[model samples]
Target: MRVFVCLFLVSVLGCSLAEGKVVSKCDLKKEFNNLPESEWPEGHTMTDNFLAKLICHVEKASEFNTSAVNQLIPKKKEEEEAEQWTLYGLFQLSDHLICSDGATPSPDRICNVTCSALVDDHIEDDISCVLNIARKVIDGGFAVERKREFWRMVKLIFQPDCNNETAGNYFAECKD
Candidate 1:
């Protein structure tokens, strides 16, 4: 009985101990490399420099926090009455396509994971989910469009810091 009770307490409380955090840039550089070489959308593959861009994008998107949330405020009056979309987790993924807040009616949850789950400490699944998004081809459907939009929204080319020309800057400070 004592052993069982202790196990139950640990099972209940252990997960609660995991919290969101702002991860380090070099740590992310190492983590991004763990993703196996895979096909990305638009016929692109995961090149080495692509990994740097990804780390940089994650840096700008969520500051590496598992709990970051970007509430996308609509600029148009027509969209004011519509449900606001949100970006969740380290990638700043959209609730409109990647997650559902549980309260909102999401007809387009591609990741099919809960928004809360995306904000948790176990991010291997989150990384896999985004990778799955990257692997999708241009299918000419809403799902693929949303996936394209995810890349567009997070694309770093326009950003002066981590754009194509400056992506390597994100890892300049860290040593292997």
Candidate 2:
């Protein structure tokens, strides 16, 4: 009986650890609310829609294919060719142009620029694009520190091989 009980306990603990800790929408909401108003991104509010998008992004990130992670890297356009933007590029540009000012850009500006740049022709509206970009900003460690911390959190979270040191390597490689 003692051996059986010990085995059962071990199995239970193993299962719980394997499942990992799930960061739910409610948890995110609580965290957002706890933050001071000054920390809220410009033009962003803690709305139901925002929460849904955030949760969706997080869920998707967990299931994302690490092998295909390279596809997220934006390709460069030739001088004569029209500018093309990948999801990665749009996120980077938004951080550099708008968020770098210490205030997040309005949704309209981000949506227009990022949505327009997406290589996928099917997506017409910028809502998803905006949400994803916002997620990148929030998770990319941009808002964490006043200055410094440019690591891409999404890449780190999704790609097992990508950590803090390698988080933004894709951007660097693409630039070169």
Candidate 3:
């Protein structure tokens, strides 16, 4: 009888613990779009509303920032290591470049403008190496005609290795 009672208590405690956890996707668009311009990297730029919303989606779906993966992998690794994650890098970059509340000076033309709005600042800092890879990616011929391209590159980086488990998981969860 005591064993059964203990099991019941354990089950009840587990249930309560599970119930305490919560995952929400709230005000997603506003989350990314409302990011301030000061957070943008030295050469990259983005509008508050768009960045807030994009970040919301990524935060919900991305598993890149966990320290489970090694940081030595190349930005274009073709395999997923148990010690490395992709969205973490991009998110770190995004956070350092545009999420933090600081003004990072750059050349006047750091970010190109369209329709009188900024696009990407392309800054590089120790906190986020994603910006450096992003600049290299942009230099590879993908023109930044719209903010959508940033999303695409992030997607690519997250899924650099099609056959790897992490990349596969990213594809399955994110679907590009």
Candidate 4:
């Protein structure tokens, strides 16, 4: 009985370790409620699928065929200057995911559209890092013209880093 109990405990611990933490927009809302709206970034174009596009770009750029490009674009977590990401990038990212042409999607929209998909796919990574960036960019105090400048930097980072001509097309839009 003692040996069986020990084995069960070990299995339980292992399972728990294998399961990582998950963060969602709902969680963000609960945590950041007291924050002011001006601090929020405003890049959500309503019609542009920013999140979907970014995801597709990241996924494709990270694949074996284009992994070289992925290597060139540093992971958000790895940068020492990660905290310095401008509000424009954040708003652009959020707007891409939640906006439907200036009509920002509610928390429920996020939960229904992407969160449900995340749960269904069993994705475990804390994508909230990017989401938070989006939130901050939208809510942060940066002005619209400054936001455009920030996006220019993002575009510069992607242009030379991408080896795939097709992926280059996406980066090109940033120029306009």
Kindly report which residue stretches of model 4 are placed more than 4 angstroms away from their true locations once superposed: 1-48, 64-126, 141-153, 157-176
Candidate achieving higher lDDT, 2 or 4:
2
| Predicted model with the maximum lDDT | 1
The 0-to-1 C-alpha lDDT of every candidate, in the order given, reads 0.68, 0.37, 0.34, 0.35
Which digits, one per residue and each the tens of the lDDT, describe model 4 over residues 5-80? 9999999766644443333333322333434454334554312234335434443433211102111222354545
Candidate 4 matches the true fold with a TM-score of 0.27
lDDT of 3 by residue, 73-175 (tens): 2354358543222222223333212223133332222223211111122212321333334454555533354334345435644433332223223223431
Instruction: Give the TM-score of each candidate.
Output: 0.69, 0.28, 0.26, 0.27
Candidate 1 clashing pairs, residues 3+ apart or interchain:
none
lDDT of 2 by residue, 1-176 (tens): 99999999999766543433344434444554555554445666656444444434543543221111122332334655433222222122333322222343333333344322332222222234545455556556334452222233243334333323221332232221
The residue ranges of model 1 lying beyond 4 angstroms of the native Cα positions read 1-18, 38-44, 77-82, 137-161, 165-167
RMSD (Å) per prediction: 6.2, 18.5, 15.3, 14.4
